[model samples]
Target chain A: MSQFSDPDATGPMAQGVAIFGEFVENAQGVTATVAVIGKKNEPLYLRLFDEYQTKELYFQSLVFVSLDVIDECVERKAMQQDMYLGFLCPIDEYQIYGYMTNSMIKFVVVLADVHRLQDFELRDFFQKVHAAYVEYLLNPFAPLDGDKIKSARFDAAIERHVATILERPPPAPGPGAKA
Target chain B: MSASANARLGEQIWQKMPKINAEFFTLTYGAMVVQLMRDLEDVQLVNEKLEKMGHSIGCRLIDEFLAKSGINNCNEFAETADVIAKVAFKMFLGVSVEVASWNDEKTSCSLLVYDNPLTDFVELPPNINLYYSNVLCGVIRGALEMVQLRVECYFVRDTLRGDDVNEIRLELKEHIKDEMAEEYRRE
Candidate 1:
């Protein structure tokens, strides 16, 4: 049994659940997730990768954080199509690429510290996602329609592709530089 | 070059390049469309994502196509279409598409795909708005766009969607000059 799951564990409890890892900003300092909001305008499911997985609580909040940007986009009547929202600098450079299909399945990719990705590169990254999603759907063992993806193959793909864009720690606060 | 030499080129490229089982390719594409329907539950949306995904694949793979073929710059759009049908299709899918039915001035042409490798053993059910082989459209549009040829490529008919023959139409929109090429890169 995991200690996080134990009922006796005492730290801070939210709705009878104990919180082991606080929602962290840099849980996986660099992370990505595929978020799906259902027809009811409710958050249906999210497929998170890397340290984002560890800091599930924090990342969950970030989903809403990302959605706030979407609401802002709609309100501003901005050409939010194929737009990336930039936030959270000084601590880390974060860019969120949000693309919504005509059917309203929102595809969003969040990047940290790396800004060199070209439009085509980002497109290729999304293709990998499309490929992975297709792969999961074809499996007979997997459920046909569900909120969560249970395929290990898809998980590995998420980890593998997300690593390609992760930036190295900003030179480790080197000498004569702001620590 | 003689027809036999061109055939040899196709064969040589096929033998040299790495290949995967055709079923895997078919399933990957099939599943992509299936997931689109299963998730989004909208036909127009599925078509949009399918082509978008294919466009993404096309942009990346065109670079590989150019490097591996080591062919010279195309002198005309005629040769470009031929290379795509014969060389690119043969090298990747192990089959060549039939390029025919050119319009006046040869600015437009239709390529009839007799056997679409992406739809092998797959059938689309009735009452569903699905473009099963949409990735092909994206591949053509993307690959052509890279070479500064602004051509509109779409499937006039798809056998997977119960059309009599698989037909892809290509119409030249404009010749994008090198100076203004970057504008076309994103769109």
Candidate 2:
């Protein structure tokens, strides 16, 4: 039970970021989900939930390179609307999505297009992850040292959130498609 | 805070302040130490691991602290110290901490955590370097570093180690500039 407090209500912005790792939906499937939230120059937090058993060292290096790429984009003021929409990378069948907060905390997500998540759906996905991250950060007992997110609550939350988003019916075809 | 900000903060605090049994909390700390001792068999390693873990927590936890506090950014080093001792400690641990021993310049200071929930029942064996509460030092250092103020925080004395008081000494180093273009271009 939550102790002592008034009626509370804050959104994802109250928390930071979550899931700096990469994970494919299934080894049986052709697509995966990857995310990163970290500093550019100084080594802060980078995680990869790799489902394909890539070498740990390799994944870490890729994250640094991705961080550098996103940093360059931000520096050039190329990110007009959103980071993910700005620079989506296709590296060896993996498509990347990036999001940078004004605070310089950059978030990146990756998946194969064969899995083909639409831009709005990806936006919704990031939003859910953001909320899960907030829940993770609010836990006083959570240890800070490692890059890997060890919170079961966060994992469970993200799973539910993502499943809900994916399970929803796709938006209808635009009126312009009437031929 | 504006009405919206206040509502947000209230919600955050509600989620953060889960009703926890103090005894359970104490026991968990005890169990953590005991497990570390068994696994590594070196008190120094245990201390090191705990500090590293604490630093990790501090790095992430600070953002939540800042967001929920709703005071916007802090101005000076002294003010930051006060917020941690007063607001942060009070909110998380339900304890009031005393900030004292400031150097003439107010760049350095000592924090006395009189009623530390982590070390409430800790009775360390006769090891001077135990630093049973070293995680506090890491948490302080980690949390402070994120706010762009680099400081060296360590224990001068610990009540668990038979010291008359539990004290942490902090000395400010040079302020950290935000990560910039020149820095990233090299990387």
Candidate 3:
């Protein structure tokens, strides 16, 4: 029941990253790499840096940080109905998947490698992980590592996820606690 | 909720008139607050200036809200909340109003944004605790309170994805709608 177990609980971008990281960890058996990028460009995997490498990137270091989306939407003057909920994740060979939220915020879980595992199960796993990442974000303490994880927010997020896994509803009183 | 009332409510008088677009108003409001912050050099001055500005907006906006909604007087806090959410915010910002649950003595509400022009590219400096696009809440509170309803307005959540939704919670202690008229009678 580790707190970070729920990947979907993390905010949208973080959730996308965590889902990709978890998928890579479970399938490729590697720790997810993190980097701090700015809003100048979309979220993409840094090919220069390995997955586990930690780095301190400035606000302007990597183009396309979080604020870029807000800026793009603003600049375009997109209408209210056109609002989108999705994640920008780069997988390989300059290919990135922007996972938008379903009505329930579940990722559609498309597969890049069909031969690796049960395609259906893997998709479900991805959706679960996405949901957990979103829950992790609700903790308010989760690290918003645009590039690398350095703050207490990330750890706190992990801790909260573990708690959610162990949490259960209280039992209904049979006779009367009030009496 | 009456049929005729709802029918009357749908009309946007401002929409037809050559009024400022919502984006322009929101951007100008945000820039004005930002400028005040830079010039005042004190939190009190900043707060006072924002209240004053909101008050001016409220005085004009209230009349428009009432006129559009066909609600000349709100007898209860619930009705007032409804008018503000349905009429005032929608007319001005093209967003819906949502009354949120309270965590404490402070009540809360949200001006739901399908699109917010003010927050465009608005990267809040990492040092600031929260953005102040919610100065509208203060304006509403100050104006309504002057009219007699004591409201504590604050942001509960910002609807902006990634960023929090701008929430303006109005906690009402008593029904002061009658007080406005009572004061007028005294005068």
Best by lDDT, which number? 1
TM-score of 3: 0.44
Against the true structure, candidate 2 reaches a TM-score of 0.45
- Residue-level lDDT of model 2, residues A103-145, one tens digit each, is 5556566555566667778777776666666545444434445
Question: What does DockQ give for each predicted structure?
Answer: 0.02, 0.01, 0.03
lDDT of 3: 0.44
Which 10 consecutive residues of model 2 chain B have the lowest summed lDDT? B1-10
TM-score of chain B of 1: 0.89
TM-score of chain B of each: 0.89, 0.83, 0.71
Question: What's the lDDT for all of these models?
Answer: 0.63, 0.61, 0.44
Better of 2 and 3 by lDDT: 2
Q: Could you tell me which 10 consecutive residues in candidate 2 chain A have the lowest summed lDDT?
A: A11-20
What fraction of the native alpha-carbon contacts across the interface, defined at 8 angstroms, is recovered by model 3?
A: 0.00
Off by over 4 Å in 2: A1-179, B1-16, B181-187
Report the C-alpha displacement of residue A145, candidate 3, in angstroms. 27
